[model samples]
Target: MLKFVLKRLLHMIPLLLGVSLLTFLLMSLAPGDYFTTLLQNPQISPDTVARLKAQFHLDQPWYVQYFYWFKSVLHGDFGYSMAYKIPATSLIFARLWNTFLLSFVAMIMAWAVAVPLGIWAAVKKDSWIDRACSLIAFVGLSVPDVLLSLLALWFAAATRWFPVGGAQSPYYDLLTPMQQFWDRVHYLILPALVLAASSLAGIMRQMRSNLLDTLRAEYVTAARARGLGEGWVIWKHALRNAINPLLTIFGYSLASLLSGAFIVENIMAWPGLGRLTMEAFFAKDSYLVVDSVVMATALLVMGNFIADLLLAWSDPRIRLK
Candidate 1:
């Protein structure tokens, strides 16, 4: 198991390098500068523009600038954001937690709901409940997250029950500690639902299909013939094998879920790394852009690692390999 983990970790290094290098190159090659918008003000003189450009090392050759970028990155200096007038690392860290919180919650909720529903659907086969769940899953898969968010916002408006968007209401800061917790969670409802909807669809459908296949396998039928309790036969034996296929994709889902967080954050004004990345990109704050990408990549790698560990724990075959 340790060897397998180590091997996977080894493989991740080059993947991260490729991601960073490609991101850096893409950002560099893009046609724009931090100064482009700033210099548009007729009141700002060329001297000021030149000074600003030089201060941020925009005057340096691309290669030289990137070399220094690599150096600073190694030393943990993620550089400054001209747009926000703050260090890139600090800004990113602030948003990172929010993004992480939302993504993790949404993914957990989706899996929790999906796995059971999937198992039930599989056990029932083409029955009405299965057909209805399939239809719901189909609609969820088809619907755009943006539209879902908008619809959720409308629902909140109509009901006046949940805060429409943002991480918290204006009264959040004024609330007592316990109320604050609940308020924030309330704010999370819409965004979390939006983020998890499609994921729930996919997970449910995948697990249902997987469980059905496992239930049909010879081992499962043999277990039933041996007078194994129905619950134990299905939940213990069939589920264990059925879940293996789901586990493989779960790692990829973690990374994709974070990527999806970007869009959801922007729509809901959740104040997360996704929104920060967008702001940095528009401002041509390459320092922030590069650092944020690297940080996101690191997070994604960590998520994948956790999934690998979970997979190993659940499957003895994986441990041996």
Candidate 2:
């Protein structure tokens, strides 16, 4: 396991470098930049623009600028964010925690609801309950997150049951600790639900399929013939094998938890990396864009790595292979 992990970590170095280079090249290909936007303002003279470009090394060749940026990145300096007028690292870190919190909880909620529901649907296949689960899953899979977020906002507005947008109420700081916690949860519910809906639907469907296949295996029949309780056969034996595919899904979910939050976060006014990255993109903030992409790519690699570890742990055959 240690050897496998080390090998994966070694592989990520060049992978990250390739991602950063490709991301930088793509950003460079985009015509105009942060300074180009500033050029439109009649008050900002050409000399000022030239000086600013030079200061940021934007005046340098693309490769030269990339080298400097990469060097700085290695030293933990993510460069400056001209749009936000903050250090890129600072800006990203400030929002990182919030994005992490939102993504983690939403994914957990998704898997939590999906697993058992999936098992139940599989076990009671073709029944009314299965049909109901299928109907709900179809709705979840069909609805676009943006539309769902908008609808959630509308519901919050009409019913006043939840905060309409944002991560917390205005008086969050003044509230008692417990009140603050619930206030955060209240604000979190709509956006989290919006984010998790599609994921939950997909996971549930996958779980149902996997579990159904496992239940049909000869092992399950053998267990039944051995006088094992149906519950024991299903829960202890079938469930363990059925869940392997879901574990893989869980790993992929770790990566998407943030990237997938973009649309929902923007619509719901959640302060997270998704909204920040969008803002940076429109503003042509090179450092911010590159940093965000690199961060996301790192997450993707890490997610796969963790997934591999889980697979090896759960199935001894994996390690032997």
Candidate 3:
């Protein structure tokens, strides 16, 4: 298993290199250079531009620039953000953490709701409960995330059940530790629900289908014949087998949450990597763009790798190979 993990980690080297290289090239080829925005103002003179260019190594050949950037990357430097006037590493990591926090909460909420509901739907297949679940799931799958988030934002305004936007309440600074916790939760509700809703529905639908299928399997029949309680047969025998697939999809859902938190982050006014990426896009901060892409890709790759290991552990049929 250790060897398998090591091998997989080693294999990611080339994939990451390809990802970085492609992002670098594509970002470099973008229509505007990082300095274009700075130069747009007539107040900035040519000598200043020349000095800025020289300082950023913009005057150098692209190869030389890439070489320097690559060297810095090896030293854990993500380069400076020309727009922000700050080191990329300093700002990016904090925002990345915010993104992670939001996405992680969303994933937890999604699985929490999805697994039980899916199991119930499967257990009660062909009944009213199952039919109702299917209808909700279909609507969830059909609703656009942006539209859903917008509706949720409006609902928050009307219901006052949650903050319409932002990561924490204004009173957070004055709160006690326990109060702070509750405040953050209060602030997170609408955004987390908005983020989790569609994901939960999808997972529930998939799990329900898989569980229903598993219930019909020969193994399940054999378990039932052994005089096992219905609950034990379903939860232990059927669910264990059925949930393997959900385990795999859960990893994908995890990756999706981490990578696709943009809409939710924006809707919540969350200070996160997605917001930074949007800013970078507008500024054409090529290095920042490439760095953000690399970070997101790395997170996804790591998520999948962990998921694979988890799947292998959960089902002995899937070994390290």
TM-score of each: 0.93, 0.95, 0.94
- At residue 157, candidate 1 shows an lDDT of 88
lDDT of 1 by residue, 1-321 (tens): 678778877978788667777777788788868897867899999899999988888888676777777778779788888888988778889888888899989998999999999999999999998998999899988998778877877888899988766887787778999999998899887788889886899999999999999999999999999999999999988999999888877888888788788888887788888888998898898888877887788888888788778878888877534
Top-lDDT candidate index: 2
For lDDT, candidate 1 versus 3, the one ahead is 1
**Candidate 1 overall Cα lDDT vs. reference?**
0.85
Q: Order the candidates by lDDT, highest first — what do you get?
A: 2, 1, 3
Model 1 misplaced stretches (Cα beyond 4 Å): 2-11, 171-174
If both were scored by lDDT, which would come out higher, candidate 2 or candidate 3?
Answer: 2
Candidate 3 similarity to native, TM-score: 0.94
lDDT of 3 at 99: 79
Query: Each candidate: RMSD to true structure?
Result: 1.9, 1.7, 1.8
lDDT of 2 at 140: 90
Name the weakest run of 10 consecutive residues (lDDT summed) in model 3: 23-32
Clash pairs for candidate 1: none
